[model samples]
Target: MYKSLLVTGVCAGLLAGPAFAQPYGYDDGNDRPEYARVIRTQPVYQSVRVDEPRQECWDEPVSYADPRYQNNVTAGGLIGAIAGGVIGNQFGGGAGRVAATALGAVVGANVGAGAAAANTPYVAHEGYEQRCRVVPNSHVEDRVIGYDVTYRYGGRSYTTRLPYDPGDHIAVDVDVQPRAY
Candidate 1:
């Protein structure tokens, strides 16, 4: 009985390994990018007050930082295939079982692909905000002189101005980034 239990555990591990693993890559820390966009030219709002030095928020590059979780495509595929095969094989018997297993794998692959595609990319919009600060790369002054503000949301990038001077910290609304797995 103990040996059978051990075998079952091993088989389960092999079959369920993918489910236990994570399926996406996302930032773990909730912090602003290392760099911020400095206001270069103004189309509206005229000149920015230098005295109101506020921290600028800028979108960091994709690789600027790593994600919290790594995409487990392999694991997801394996899990889907196993689950699909088991479910598909239930109705079929003998020769039919083999056919069912094959069908299950195909269905599983599709399901896995669909699941991966469901994962969304980054997003920015109104209502939602992203807090940001000055990047270390800035060599201008001790305080933020200005920021190149172009807030984008719902597929629209709207250039705007800072209502208040950015201090040591500031909160800029950002769209929720989708998970990538």
Candidate 2:
């Protein structure tokens, strides 16, 4: 009888040891998996203000005249004076010719200067300049960061925010714990 009682006790202990050593929630009957009906799922959005930098470019026309042609004015006046004096020397006699030559030289110098200014070559340099500025193009965008889920579980309504949509039903963890009064 003592040997039989020892065998029965050993068998009972072996069965109970596994039940006690099991993990807290698995098959322990207190914690299990259940589903909650999703009543409404509203997408939670975040207002994001984005600033995108873009390069906007356009061509601007630029032009300038070369300054090397300015020396022609003096050369033109001297040439005109010599031509005028020769023409005047052929006109009058003696002192009159001298007076005429002086007047003609003066008139020729003035005319030559004027002609040189008008005939100067204007070297125009035409080109385009690319100018740019950083413009802040901003716009507000609504991004769905999460979902506001309203669900009914065990005849009670609860609201929670989830990172993804749970469709019509959401799997929930049901943990039953003794109330501490």
Candidate 3:
């Protein structure tokens, strides 16, 4: 009986050795296979660009002009009117000169204003948003680093420098002002 008890005690101790560090059934060891160390790291180094979400703007007071239509409206109209009147003069003479010039000016102004209007903010709340995340690093150089960090402002995913560690907090960038673009 003594010999049997000793054997049972030794077996129990051997089984429980790991439990001393953790729980009875818990395994905190990194069970990654030896080959896992040679994990293939794709050189994509790609990461979700954590940028300010695409935002929509409404018709706001003219703070600045978009370079696209700026010249078209400001100088294009005046120049067009001048050209139109000169052409008008080609058709008529004497008083026709004044009349044609005025007509050309009106047309030019209208065209210029129309061109400017093209840049008018098409204001409609079509609820547009940007996709961003609170990233710790700029990009993934080797492996697809997992990220668990969440942002408060926008629901975006960001990779952290914490080496794929779980339960890490991250931040996002979302501060776009009118005419700042």
What is the TM-score (0 to 1) of candidate 3?
Answer: 0.26
- The 10-residue segment of model 2 with minimum total lDDT is 22-31
lDDT at 153 for candidate 2?
82
**Candidate 1 on 1-181: residue-level lDDT in tens?**
9999999999999999988874232234666533233333333334433444457776543332113122444455677888888888887789999999899988896787566545633233334345588644323234444454554333444554664444333344444576999
> What is candidate 2's lDDT per residue for 68-112, written digit by digit as tens?
555687778898898888888888899999999998898888888
lDDT of 1: 0.57
The list of candidate 3 runs beyond 4 A from truth reads 1-71, 119-181
**TM-score for each predicted model, relative to the true structure:** 0.27, 0.49, 0.26
Please tell me which predicted candidate would have the highest TM-score against the true structure.
2
Compared with the true structure, what per-residue lDDT tens digits does model 3 show for residues 1-181? 9999999999999999977765222334555321101112222244555434444444433333445555556675676677676666666678977787778778877776676557554333333344444534343234455433332322333332434533323322333345945
Candidate 1 residue 48 Cα shift, in angstroms, is: 63
